[model samples]
Target chain A: MVCIMKFDNEKCGYCGACTSVCPNSSLELTENKLIIETDKCDDCKRCSIVCPLGAFLEVEGN
Target chain B: MKYDVIVVGGRIGGSVSSLFASKNDLDVLMIEKQPEIGVPLQCAEATSEETFQTIGIKPSNRYICSEIHGAELHSPDGNHFRMYPHNDEIGYILDRKVFDKSIAIQSAKAGTDIMVKTTVKDLIIREGKVKGVIAKHLGRTMEIEADLVIAADGVGSNVARMAGIDTLFGTKDIGSCVQYKMVGMDVDPNLMQIYFGNEIAPGGYVWIFPNEDGVTNVGVGIRNHKKTAYHYLNKFLSNFEATPVEMNIGGVPLSGTVDKTYTDGLLVVGDAAGHVDPLTGGGIHLTVICAKIAGEVAAEAIKGEDISAEFLKRYEERWNDKVGNVIKKSLKYRKVLDKLNDKELNALAKFMKGRDLDSITSASLLGLVKESPSLVRHLKDII
Candidate 1:
């Protein structure tokens, strides 16, 4: 059970802000697409906080 | 066991060396420390098509991510310049792991024995000339003799140093880098973004290479003297809206090549030789090219039964004649680049904004010095 970050496409601007902040490399951009690797995700929440559009949501209590 | 040539570190350079040696009917053995040939890939894998053609390698779809039409340069102040293909030539970003393994496979087909999970602990030196390597596999250390040994062991090559080749590189000579592979990245499918400024990556730049698989490999590299690369890239990227899915960290030795890449019975190629371009920090093209040179030279030496420093100097001479000037010139540009502040970089961006200038090739960047001739006059010696 690990905490995870999810992206909200509606609020996402596709600016690549969150992907760049992550140190653990849990997040990736695919064809202008953003997908998170759950196993690699440390759930640092840097992505959620850095999203200017407020598109990132944290799933707690994995 | 004895081989005609024993190659250490089976990446592009090592494999290329083995391939050439084997193709020339020399007994070659390639030893790789990694369990898999190209696993846990360490490179960005982008190289010019000219490299592929020269190496006689053709990618089989698994290796190519995007056929780069050109590169887009963005300044800190948001000014931009697009450098289209000068000769309608497209470069490519590859699946490096696959590409490396493919080369090793090809070398095997050409008759080079491939050994993975095998580490070369030290060089077997006698009478001040390299003869072979002391390697370990399956918890057993063994000696493999060879007429010549090719060292392609990447940036921090222990083999190079053990073989009595000096491996000292200046702090300014290295580029530290970090990258993120983000999925669902909504980037312009065609263009690769190169961001330059002191605030972004002093003495270096940030790059966003979009892969065709709906992912973007976002990375930043900076000189060692500047702030930590991760710090700046993380800070600057906080302003964007995309989320990171994966992260990668690596280093590129971006200075000109070492004074000598070859010695008695020894040759160092690729990053081990500091063969990266100073201006663009691109090493793939040179790595493959230098590997080809090392391969050809080692083969010729084996065929002629001459492996002296004088004989092996052929490889050194050949590279200098073809790509040496470009490397020497780029180091000069790197010196000029290190002197620029944020304001100067911003002004540089503003200066070239929307002018439809030529490509950002090595020559074009140096050409900028012509407009401001006095700015880099002190660097004329290296330029």
Candidate 2:
């Protein structure tokens, strides 16, 4: 299975909160952009929990 | 490009670091990732007179949006109280859009070169010592060398981690925050207001800081919740007749400073180093003070010709001497708040009403213990 998290770029505020709380070190946020390290993610919902705009969503990945 | 210092993330911490480093006659460069300094501000913009004094700058009328004389506290059960951090001292609600640029301008005037629209992709590390940074601006990359690198990159703190320091904050230590710059808020013009409840703010509180005239900053900071802070903030705004013109989202480190803020040729300050009041999540004063020390210590180390970690440790020592006790005490208070239930909060709020917040003593805790054993037991841990 691949990374099960999907980010809604259109809805994201790009605040970088998700990057700080990611226990697996799987998120990166630069200026006006957020990059998710999918390979390192462990399906942790921390990003979804803290995202101010509800931009992160869980999905079944192949 | 080479310089004596490269200050990353040009907010208050970066600008202050570059400003002081330049003032000490060191060639300094400050790099800000944002296209403009202070656009899309993440702070509630509240700070005290002590901040300006420590930076040795006069508070300009251009950035001072409102002067706060005191604060009002609210409990879940409708109990309320008023207090101030210091007696007979004024605070400020700033237009940070202007204040941040003003500090960057000051840094520039002090001979520190500034680069906007620049991002540090990685640090230059050799033999486990930070030598410089590989930065990119608008798709063009360059290796800029420096004797010292100060990481002031706010909460993410990616730069410090590149130097092999553990700056990753767990969810428990982070406060997910959202704020709106609102107009038509009907609140006391001179007093900032705080509302508390687990159901209301979950792990944090809601603040309605009145700006000059009718503008106010209404916000909420929540921790470790499934629902977002924006949801709680919107719920809180329903009671007030306000219109939001702008929104800001961010996180705060409330678990106090990281175990280490310095490494070989690298220093961390501001929110990156967790130089924030853990209880209040206010880093404005602490960041200014700590970043200034970082700059001075960097300059001192360079002048002494020892940029090693052993010599740079003085930054941590000096800052800890100045504000360590304050953060320690605030951490204890935050722990006490963490253990309280809504009933205990209401009881404590009622007991402390009309009493000076700073004057909570053993006698007061004893009086409170008589009412709620659980509440005072946790509060006693702080003593």
Best by DockQ: 2
For candidate 2, the chain B TM-score comes to 0.97
Question: Which segments of candidate 1 are over 4 A away from where they belong?
Answer: A1-62, B356-383
lDDT of 2 by residue, B1-383 (tens): 89999999999999999999999999999999999998888998999998999999999999998999888989998889988666688989999889989999999999999999999999999888898999999899999999999999988689998898888888878888999989998889889999999988988899988877688999999888888898899888887777998899888989999989999999999999999999988889999999999989999988998889999988999999999999999988987898888999999889879888678777887888889888877776665
Q: Which candidate number would show the highest lDDT if scored against the true structure? A: 2
Q: State which docking tier applies to candidate 2.
A: medium
Question: What DockQ does candidate 1 have relative to the true complex?
Answer: 0.02
Which run of 10 residues does model 2 chain B get worst, by summed lDDT?
B374-383
Stretches off by above 4 angstroms in model 2 are A1-3, B358-367
lDDT of 2 at B201: 92
lDDT of each: 0.75, 0.89
Q: Enumerate clash totals for all models, in the order shown.
A: 37, 0
What is the C-alpha lDDT profile of model 1 across B1-383, one tens digit per residue?
A: 89989998888888887888888888999998878877655566678887788778675688888878877898777888777765888888888888888889999999999888887877888787899999888789998998899998776566777776765454456666667776765777677889988778776888888877787888877764324566777886787767777666555667688778888889998878878888887888887888888888888998898999999999999988878988888878787867766656665665566544453355755766755544445434643
